[model samples]
Target chain A: MVNDNILGIIAGILTSLAMLPQLLKVLKEKNVDDLSPLMLITLILGLSLWVWYGVFKRELPIIYSNAFAVLVNLSLLSCYFLYRKSG
Target chain B: MVNDNILGIIAGILTSLAMLPQLLKVLKEKNVDDLSPLMLITLILGLSLWVWYGVFKRELPIIYSNAFAVLVNLSLLSCYFLYRKSG
Candidate 1:
């Protein structure tokens, strides 16, 4: 049980922070042509759902990780639009 | 409880399949220059751990969803390598 909790925590941390690199890359390059807006939109929807699911289940790990993911993806999405518009 | 379960299922489906559009985009365009390999790697690692966490908890939804996510990310990672090498 303890091991499972640790695993969940680690997994949550990794997944939540996974997009940091991509966000940094886009910020550095200011290019969004190859990145798919549909993907980001779908992911954001999914992450939001996960947050709601977590709320229902009272799963803090799921809630926190996915909430953070939502924020990151939202930032990425905004960057996508911001950069795409300028070009 | 049933509503919560349903929410979890839907969330699982959405999050697990979120990368499909991105995968299709990569296949059609053969361009992953904007995608970050580190992000994919981190996501894959996280998904793998989610699978293990699910197994430990005997939660089928978590296991299946994360397993599928791992597959998607792995394919994305392979494409990243395949295209990055050629270009």
Candidate 2:
């Protein structure tokens, strides 16, 4: 059986990196017309809450994952604003 | 102090609904130029793992949230494929 820790780590890593591709795409294309600001804002809010919950639970995986996610999402939001005018 | 369960539930709901706006945007615009398929795939994989981890931990919040996330992600994936050609 897969260890729970391993599962958590994998899930955490996956969740953390899930937005990386989207961020990269926006950076490369320098356009975010197809992206939605509301989506990013909602995601960031949710992730921030997750970070708080993780801290409260003392779950290292959750804390680290959501923290990383928040960073990625912030970058995405920045890109949206930066390139939105070009689009 | 806020209850841990309440935090978990709120986090779960937030996480689950985070993608709803994105999905709606894609549906409305019928374009996914800014969206990356890899992101959706990675997110779904992560959410699936979270569901498994939640089951192992016997955490209802985790299971329900991730399960809902998986459904939303699947919809996004379908949208990505469907609308990508239009872009």
The weakest ten consecutive residues by lDDT in model 1 chain A span A1-10
Q: Write the per-residue lDDT of candidate 2 for residues A1-87, one digit (tens) a residue.
A: 889879999999898788677778778988787677887788788888888988887777778888898898899889888888752
The TM-scores that each candidate's chain B achieves against the reference are 0.87, 0.87
Per residue, candidate 2 scores C-alpha lDDT tens digits across B1-87 of 988778889887776677777778778988776667887888899989989988997878778888998998899889888877753
Worst 10 residues of 2 chain A by lDDT: A31-40
Candidate 2 chain B weakest ten by summed lDDT: B78-87
Error of 2 at B69 (Å): 0.8
TM-score of the candidate numbered 1?
Answer: 0.85
Error of 2 at A77 (Å): 1.7
Candidate 1, residues A1-87, lDDT tens digits: the string is 458778879999998788688788888999876577887888889889888877876777778888999999899899998999663
- The TM-score of candidate 2 is 0.85
RMSD of 2: 2.6
